[model samples]
Target: MADENAEETYDNFEKQAADQAANLVEQLLAALPEPETRNKPDGGLNPVEAARRQPAPQPGFDGTIASFAVNHDVLVPGLYLSRQDGDIATYDLRLVKPNQGGYFSMAAGHSLEHLLATWLRSSAYGRQVVYVGPMGCRTGFYILLRGMKQAAAVSLIREALQAAAAYNGAVPGTASTAECGHVAEHDPAGARQLAETAAALLKDWTAADLVYPA
Candidate 1:
């Protein structure tokens, strides 16, 4: 009876959390500005005028990328807080050690991206997840979360990776060309292997380990 009661309480908590997250998202969407309505005197946008009004492009990838300043030579395989903007926090899920030749293959990274995103979006904190994608460096991936505690984010990543590692079915969002642009490049086996490796590496990870090694 106690176990049953505990399960019931936990279910209620999860439901409430989901409902609150949904309400917040609805409010944010409602607050977003409507599509640009500016038009030229002729009732059509002028490409030349629009181009002139745009901000000048930076030399290369902006002058202030926090990740670029990170010393990759000393960076190890672990989770690190990349940056924070307003309510969102970007996390670096480093799967492979930096400057090592053990980088994930293209197929492996692509497959893992699909698997990780799918599993994460279906987790308890799914509503907090802003985005999930592979890093250009091929050493790891990035996950953006909104208003999440560091401990909860760490827990979410660990559990999601464990789930991905054990996953044995059709990779989500890769059923056909209609679903994915590069459908032929997925490798479930390779993705699972990567997930397994990452899961083990983060088995004991905690919020305290979130900082980049100095």
Candidate 2:
């Protein structure tokens, strides 16, 4: 009886996730500058190819811009160039699809952001780790690294992700009132799984994945 109840609960969770994903798909399709295609020209976009997507400057908002709205349909989970100025490069480190791939609960995204930011700031390439934060969309993160090119940036992120995947210790700085906002919402275990999933997707990082849909 207990097992049956647990199975039913799991089914409910899956249903909820599926329903949420479907709703998001509708929203993304409506917002995209380009229409969603049933098939990608090729199998699909590979690697950091998405790196070339730069947000066009908005009229106002103090020079703030939006990401390439057209390519939202093609954006996949991986490293992509967000923008660059001099030695500073911002990357869209997508973990979930814009609307359909996977969903990160708010608590999960928050914990992952905290842990990832902490890890990146302390890694061997820590000097280049400019910033690591979650996107408003909650599908992934925006990572800014200084003094690194695309390939180097990918390597740095891959290593950091591997670390996050293997992580088993307490999430640093997530429990202190003075240290974080909503610190009690941390979910280190969930965060680790997200990291592991992303790392697997990038294990064989290749040049093929470096080009966005043409």
Candidate 3:
């Protein structure tokens, strides 16, 4: 009976997550800029030419971004080097499978972002840590570092996540309104849950695993 109830609950959760993901995708598509229009030789609207000549939405940027180019269908929960710009290396700390009906709630993602950022910024390799933040999709995080070797970066991520899983006391830097915009939205327990999950998935993870699955 207990197992049956648990299975039912899991099914409900999956349905809710799928529904929410679909809605978010809809909203994103709705917000995209319309393709620029062009006049045909006969003065009728020419959509094909318009789309081909549409200015890049972001200034000076051409072509699909690196993150979008990744084949999300095969991505799994693990650390990956998303890209590198000069000395900066951006690491994708994927905690959930992409579009798999599993995701971090906003509160959980918010809390984990704070915890991980605080810990990583003060770690031994802190000097090389450039930035730490969550992905918009709520599936993972991106950490940027400079002048750090792949092996060192791997160890750094493992240590930071382990610390987060074992963390106690107040979440760092969320003490007041000045420190955080949504102070009450944080869920430290949820953050710890996510950290533990990610840590387990990354157990025995090596620099070799940093490559995104082909």
Q: How much lDDT does each candidate structure score?
A: 0.90, 0.79, 0.90
| TM-scores of all predicted structures | 0.71, 0.66, 0.71
TM-score, cand. 1: 0.71
Estimate candidate 2's alpha-carbon lDDT, on a 0 to 1 scale.
Answer: 0.79
Write down the RMSD of all candidates, one decimal each: 20.9, 26.1, 26.4
Candidate 3 deviant stretches above 4 angstroms: 1-62
Off by over 4 Å in 2: 1-66
lDDT of 1: 0.90
Cα lDDT of model 2 by residue, 165-192, tens digit = 8989888886578888787888888899
Which 10-residue span in candidate 3 carries the lowest summed lDDT?
36-45
Clashing residue pairs in candidate 2, if any?
46-209, 47-209, 48-209, 49-210, 49-211, 51-80, 51-81
Evaluated against the true structure, the overall lDDT of model 3 is: 0.90
- Write the residue-wise lDDT of candidate 3 on 1-214 in tens digits: 9999999999999999999999999999999987544655433446686576777676666777889999999998899999999999999999889998778988888999999888988878878889999899999999999999999888888889999999987988789989999998999999999999888888899989899999
Cα distance off (Å), candidate 3, residue 3: 99
Name model 1 segments beyond 4 Å from true: 1-62
